[model samples]
Target: MTSAPPLAPSFDAARALRQARETFDIEAAAVAGLKNRLTDAFSRSVQLMLEVRGRVVVMGMGKSGHIGRKIAATLASTGTPAMFVHPGEASHGDLGMIQVNDVVVAISNSGESGEITVLLPVLKRQGVPLIAITGGLQSTLARHATEVLDGGVDKEACPLNLAPTASTTAQLALGDALAVALLDARGFKAEDFARSHPGGALGRKLLTHVSDVMRSGEDVPRVAPDTAFGDMMREMSAKGGITAVVDAHQQVLGVFTDGDLRRLIENGIDLRTKCAKDVMHLRPRSIRPDALAVDAAELMEEHRITCVLVVESDGSLVGMVHIGDLMRAKVI
Candidate 1:
């Protein structure tokens, strides 16, 4: 058999990177263009959302549906109650999700998506306000909307100029802008965001209290200020690292950590005769039980300590938290 010629490399890494950059540049420009187009329509959408007694129901088809779902999540997380419904599914009974008090945000690049346009009359008859995000202001979707926000793009990022690229980017940016406006108007704070996302790391950092992760009750290593150093060592070892040295009233006087023990040993102090009060570090770093876990972590990091005592406002030790506890809680 005759030998076949070696095939040339089919992949061009440089060209691929150049094409990706081009796509990003096009979309960036599209989003940037939306800044100058911000008008009364944008304000009207925000006002409608702010006044909504019901959820913001977002509807779109194809790629717009994907973007709409993200927009809905952003709105819901940022303090606005919102949800996305596929327009095709809405016609098949999902329309029931829309209530008269809800504001409908219908997205269609051409404003002529059959799946979305067909529901316009039903939505209007139900007395629901419709906000259209479309490239063509004169499109059918825009004509039916109570308010219209132009999401027009000069061109698609696709070389063929057919794919929903730049237009979707504009829609996503506009949706984010609306969500932020609503968030500011509502005075939504980080605590509110943490409440909405209690399962995420940010929630843990912002919402997890010192009491939630502190070692409490008998698990908290503690000793009286006059306790023998040997006895304090036993308590610290039993509890695995540090012990709070408290007074007669169970008020924390100081903390004796493993580092303190090492320092005492280096100084050749008699461990059996020395008292905890003689070797403990006074006014040790501490946090309140109600403080955020992240705050505890920050205190520990700032002092280069491994553990902190959780105390009451009156300096009574209630619990103890270690760096490991914060790490395990994902608050670090």
Candidate 2:
């Protein structure tokens, strides 16, 4: 018989919980320490980035490289033009991606990654400003950088204290601080952020105006208030489920929906001769054409209605937006 496989270690729930809590406490303390360390150098780094004619080129090695990628993405999304460049890749041929007008943010806990140190001279030669984020004040990266933002941690959360834990946490927090500071300095607005993030729900809420999604012109089922109930039913059928009861000037007097028809039929009203004004819902909910699609959704949900009239400033009906349209536009 083959030798039996070694037994796995027994599970220890208490030990696992203790270890997780210890890790969280250590990382939290590391991030908290950064508050006292924000110095004039941090401000200068933000100014340097603001003045950069080109992108912020972030570089690091190993774990720092991973954190650097996230920092670059945060910077880019928050109005700063930033990209991550692996130091090893820089030596191979990617250094060409960096330009003299760009600001380079070099991250290294020890500040002695050979891959990054090796490219320092090249960056210097190109006149690129270097901002260093490192755990050591006297590290090689700190010495060569134009500005230094200390990302030091008291100790690692790792049991062996060898794996990067608290140090990376501090670095990531510092990177976020930098991105937010730059965003504020640039006066970046919510609409600007929405423009960059147009694929998500938040973007739709901010960027989609009512006119863009509302059914307008002839597609809007509009009937005069004096219209006979038979003609009103035809208008509702042709327009889907509802019709705008308006005057000759296209000013919405009221709205007639399928629900209203059901109530009328239940009240034993004769559909053949009665007029739309006799059974229309007066003071129906209306939204301006310039309002956000999200606003329309809110109104529909609040009133428990399926559609709302889009009107101009003068109370004239301009369009109609249905719940189905909002759903198709992913605004609901």
Candidate 3:
């Protein structure tokens, strides 16, 4: 008989799952440890970011460097001006980019990397303030920095305990925590973000207003309540808008638009039986004259129509603004 096939090696899936849970717990502990440790150093970092007259330069090496870049970007977007600098690049003459007025955030787990350590003497000589994020409080980097943020973890999540995975994740979380703390301390608002990001959608959403972008005065298509359907049709045509505002005593009575006309015709209703009160949409959705134009645009979109009523403090029809008006002015 042929020799039996060799049996496969025994593997327990439950054991593998237990190992994964152990690694997860290690990382969780690393993060949970941070909540109780925030002290004066955190406050000082916030104060430094607030008082910084120039950009914050973030420096780190290898994996820490990657985390540094993300931290810098988060800081910049949240009100603090910041940028990333590689430790290796700084050693090769990029150190000149730092100024005495600027703050330097140097990250290192060992706190003894040659590339980062080499810049210390020069930074000290130039009077640049240094902040360190490190695992070991007694490491050279911590000793040299004006502020030391503890990024310590009990152990790594790697199976062999040799990789930087869990340590780097912890450090990244700590950096983000610092940035968000600074952001709140500065009372940074959406308006401030809009100023920094004029091209971004958030800026557009928060900043663009109707008054700044709406068409006004005689250009608005309008007619008296008693005006004939023929005259209202002419007004709509002349204004090239979907609707015309009807007024009496300078107060808006109703709105006449193409949709209204279609509904009347489709039902075979008496065209003459319908006057402004009978044919026009009564008490149509209206917007404050002083409200943001974007609000008006939103109203139009919400109703799946292209027209809006612009009302005054006394509910009078001061004018009418259309989607075209808002779009042409780029308010929409």
Candidate 4:
């Protein structure tokens, strides 16, 4: 005799929306509850991570393993040396990856994942400091942990209360909290973050400097203060649509752009006698080559202009950056 087949799950739009809202509420409460549970253990955990000479080894099982991977990534990107080592794999030869100087962050909602529990004695023998993120205060993981972070949730968002929902959210929140505290303690800055994420958007904005994208050398349009209007126009048209007026020492005196020529023509001003110095706009907006490319974009946006000259501290013209250059670099 065969058992009856399970029925297909029925969908209810109104019930689905209600469940979504409840899930959010439960998850939010789970995170909020962590604030009151903060103890000196959090600081100790951060100090352990900060002082570790080797990488942070994060371990977990099942759903907790997924969260562990994310936590490891967050820690690594935030200036902490960290990587995830699956508990199941650790029971294999992968346990060799852990070093005595490394710190271990173990995650388990029940605090009794067998794979993680089995490795406790070995970790203890190796003298690796363990920080446990778990809900069971008196479970095996908590017992062996040098620091135990309470990730307890009153109830799961799942209707059956069997799935890891609110519990996992609480674990993730705790992981973020750890990373944030560790980063703060280490004095991690945006520049450090950009260095770790050189391929990301923030990296592009922070690591890319004006020198990286600015037109330099012969590509930069420039003219002497006494250069003839026709000669300056020729240089500007050949280089870019703008020309910088400089002294004998290459110290920027002013700038003349295509817009200036258009305005001069519109006003019917005599241009035949107008040398670079005669028609140039004095003290045009400029940026240092070491400045972030985003700053150059901001300067262009603020001045309602499409080009910005790059200069040294002493105001010597080094290069020029156009909005087009910034666009090509994706700095804008």
Candidate 5:
């Protein structure tokens, strides 16, 4: 028998790109479907959540279990304390973790899992509210649930239409929707998130204070505006900062620095005979003492300055901030 011709090597980059784009487009279309369908089911889900006296219990199997863990984590970090419980484990005696006041959030793409189906009755008997996140609106799990959240995708991104791709993406986006809605309803603030993420860079940025970093009192270099340029140099050098604030009536009139002295010399000004006001940088950039350290950093960058005078709201000089202070705080 004649052998079939060897299969040709299909070399089509455009075909691969088209397939990749199709997957993302399918997921996008599925998530977009959830935007206009805020039904009584969604309201009941939120209401049951609000009324519960205990934490939310998230459960799923397979790929949904992975998504459930992430959803639980996001909800926990955003003001709703929740934990993932594997339905398979629950049948193996983990269901005892479910309290009478807790709410059960069961996630299954098809709304039917042998493990999850086995535990539905026990949860119902315990009077735990069951919130189902599933792809099918008429599945047995949806019918058994106290509230059903539909995350149905028109089709799977898998070439065989078998793998959980677009459906799982839709489930995650809906899970995030629930978390963000609850977060805003609870008046969750940036500071609240910072408390939960204290080791993160954002926590450091939001919680940092001016008093924690500013050079206060005598450590902040200051001198009278009428002080001679020669005397100002001594003050600036003794303080070890780049500049000295020239104060008049307790408010900064300008600043004199090593740079200013160099400019003064190059400009033919007699250093010993000139006053600080005559050669100082007039009306220099300053920040309020109560401003966030990050805001101070921004002002420093915007003006291309290495240091700034910390002033009171009434314009009186209070302290100083430097690039070094921001770097030490690890906020730069």
Candidate 6:
């Protein structure tokens, strides 16, 4: 018969909480310690990466490898071209990915990872610069490195003093510092980062133009200035909740919305005899089709209105954007 599963040990919430606090203290100190250790080598490393013609190839083993992957992604998204290659795979044939123009960032807490050490001579032969993130300054990886970054920590947060908790934190923090320095050196901006992250929220805000999300053609609700109030209300209800008042050349005269209708009724104005021009708000806020979708959202928010007209330079109405449209596009 199959044996039953073993029961879990008794819980210790207080001890668990104490251990967690100690872990935070140890890791925070590990990262903070790096600030004191920063020397000219750190700036040189950034300069080397900034001048690289090709990508930054990050390599590490196990946990360091995980941190290396994140570093590569951060660097790539921040304007530096980078990629992660597994060290073990490099031993076989993936080393071919490293070109002379590429800069290799190798992470090893002990600075003597056998897999990485074995590739040092080959990297040197290929003339690829090696930046080592290691706790071992006198170790083999550092000896072959073009630049040495101190990633040492006094101890691990692990109770046994064996796990890589503090060391990995230091490595990650150092990697982030390098990326930030290179980003500034390269003059990378938010818009440039957004181009690399087109599907993200910031990308949508910066890259999405007014023409992309506005309702155009028949979807836009528009009526001549002399249109009957009842007819304008029909157009508004059929479209969204707003109608644009336009002239013979389709230039925007004004706009009327559900908000205006309520205010007119509150003032006891008889709408049955009025036309679109009589009730429309003059000089309604408008945006151009070339502006960012986020700008449209900001316009609606600033005026406390639900919609705005997309117009040409000459004030001709082209499209309409509603708050709901911006919401659906997630520009806000």
Candidate numbers sorted by lDDT from highest down: 6, 4, 2, 1, 5, 3
Model 2, residue 161: C-alpha shift (Å): 1.1
Candidate 2 TM-score versus the reference? 0.93
Tell me each candidate's TM-score.
Answer: 0.95, 0.93, 0.77, 0.93, 0.82, 0.96
What lDDT does the true structure give each of the candidates? Answer: 0.93, 0.94, 0.80, 0.95, 0.84, 0.95
Compare the candidates by TM-score and give the number of the best one: 6
Q: What is the C-alpha lDDT profile of model 6 across 100-183, one tens digit per residue?
A: 999999999999999999999999999999999999999999999999999999999999999899999999999999999999
* lDDT at 255, model 2: 90
**Which regions of candidate 3 fall more than 4 Å away from where they truly are?**
1-23, 211-227, 230-241, 246-253, 262-268, 272-278, 281-283, 288-290, 297-306, 311-332
Residue 62 displacement in candidate 2 (angstroms):
1.0
Worst 10 residues of 2 by lDDT: 269-278
Q: Which whole-number lDDT from 0 to 100 does residue 49 have in model 5?
A: 74
RMSD of each: 3.6, 2.5, 6.3, 2.5, 4.9, 1.6
Residue range 247-266, candidate 3, lDDT tens digits:
55667777888877788789
Model 4: worst 10 consecutive residues (lDDT sum): 7-16
Instruction: Give the TM-score comparing model 1 with the true structure, all chains together.
Output: 0.95
* Candidate 1, pairs of clashing residues: none
Worst 10 residues of 5 by lDDT: 240-249
Predicted candidate 2 versus true structure: per-residue lDDT over 160-233, tens digit per residue? 99999999999999999999999999999999999999998889989998999999999999899788888988
Off by over 4 Å in 6: 1-9
Error of 5 at 264 (Å): 1.9
Q: Which residue ranges in model 5 land beyond 4 Å of their true spot?
A: 1-12, 36-38, 216-219, 223-231, 238-241, 245-254, 273-284, 311-318
